[model samples]
Target: MSKPNIIQLSEFDITQKIIESLSNVCTRAVLFSVKNESKDATQIAEELKISLSTVYKTLSNLEDLALAEVDKFIISPEGKKIKQYRSRIGKVEITVDNLEPSLNLYPNTDNPKSSL
Candidate 1:
């Protein structure tokens, strides 16, 4: 039998990736709430407690990660669908089981018996 290989992420990007994962879930919820409506970048901004531009950036990041998608079109202030930016499903799977919390399942740091 062959042993398994492990790949680790850089300490810097690990945190960023975690933050991105959290942001991903949040964006999904926001999209689901406004599934049938056209939500502007400002709306997402407010909902996410971030700047309008932050919302745009976050959405762009989410889209790039394939965690969400947007449909851009013209819209009117009079409740008209002039140009709507519709959000849709573009989920990214995250397999957590194989990652953190299992790195050192059976440590031999103090295995006195093995010293025999």
Candidate 2:
């Protein structure tokens, strides 16, 4: 029996999607603060120094786009609904520019190289 091979993801695949989803100021704020860890909207607002209303609205937008996910609700110390929000993917990818067009871009690179 042969084992299957695994592949890694590229920056281009997820960067644009994340950027587009996080275009809004509030959304971007939440994403930036929560870049390393999952956080609730209230916490995001506090971390970014924004209003709770704005954070909730922005998080809702992110949730709709599926770039960020809302976790199960839990009661916080303040007696408010707290739900963790984290990015759907681990990293953001962006395509490179001005390549020579003649490189083995992937594992299966049998395609003829492009001209300069």
Candidate 3:
């Protein structure tokens, strides 16, 4: 895998949002679960042992933050469309200097071993 790009953010509002999301246990779990492979909500929910509704909600939040994206869609046996989500972020680093916080976002790579 190629070296991933790092996105540094020092803006207070955006940085705060990212910090909050990363601080949440559920959000971190969901993001980590999809780091290597795309997975549907049901799969993520089962893997994390969280409720389906919570998975859906977390996916929405991730999308809003541009941390997760819909990699593809699948047609279930019942002819229902299911979204397969992947994490856009492979790793995150936070720094606090002079009472200011900043974030370093590492983009996810195609190689599973390269992902966090």
Candidate 4:
């Protein structure tokens, strides 16, 4: 899989979306889980002890923020395709200037690893 592109969230509209993505505790946990490793949604839920539905919701939010990238799809014996998610954002910087908030994102630099 190709590396995710760096995302800058400094615009007024984008900054709000980024903030909203990281607002939930479950979402933050999901980010931490995939920071240096790729994990399927099931693994994320089990590792974080969060409900699968919550994890899925958080993953969706992160995807919208471009903070989570689909590393690959694993085909199950039943022909089901499972998506492995990795954190595309290696760093997040939030700053407030002139009463306005800005967010800066750094893309993950590490090589992709199997979700095995």
Residue 31 shift from truth in candidate 2, angstroms: 1.9
* Residue-wise C-alpha lDDT for candidate 4, range 1-116, written one tens digit per residue: 45333333333266776777677677888997998878899999999898999889888878766678788899989999999998876777788899888776666676343211
Model 4 TM-score is: 0.80
Question: lDDT of each model, Cα atoms only?
Answer: 0.44, 0.54, 0.81, 0.75
All models, RMSD in angstroms: 16.3, 12.2, 5.4, 4.6
Ranking by lDDT: 3, 4, 2, 1
Best by lDDT: 3
Candidate 4 accuracy as lDDT: 0.75
List the lowest-lDDT window of 10 residues for candidate 3.
3-12
Residues 5-90 of candidate 1: C-alpha lDDT, one tens digit per residue: 11223222343453454456655555443445556676766766767666666566544433334455556667665323443432
Could you say which candidate leads in TM-score?
3
Candidate 2 lDDT:
0.54
Error of 3 at 95 (Å): 1.3
User: Global lDDT for candidate 3?
Assistant: 0.81
**In what order do the candidates fall by TM-score, top score first?**
3, 4, 2, 1
**Higher TM-score: candidate 1 or 3?**
3
**Every model's TM-score:** 0.43, 0.53, 0.84, 0.80
Clashing pairs in 3: none
Candidate 4: stretches off by over 4 Å: 1-12, 111-116
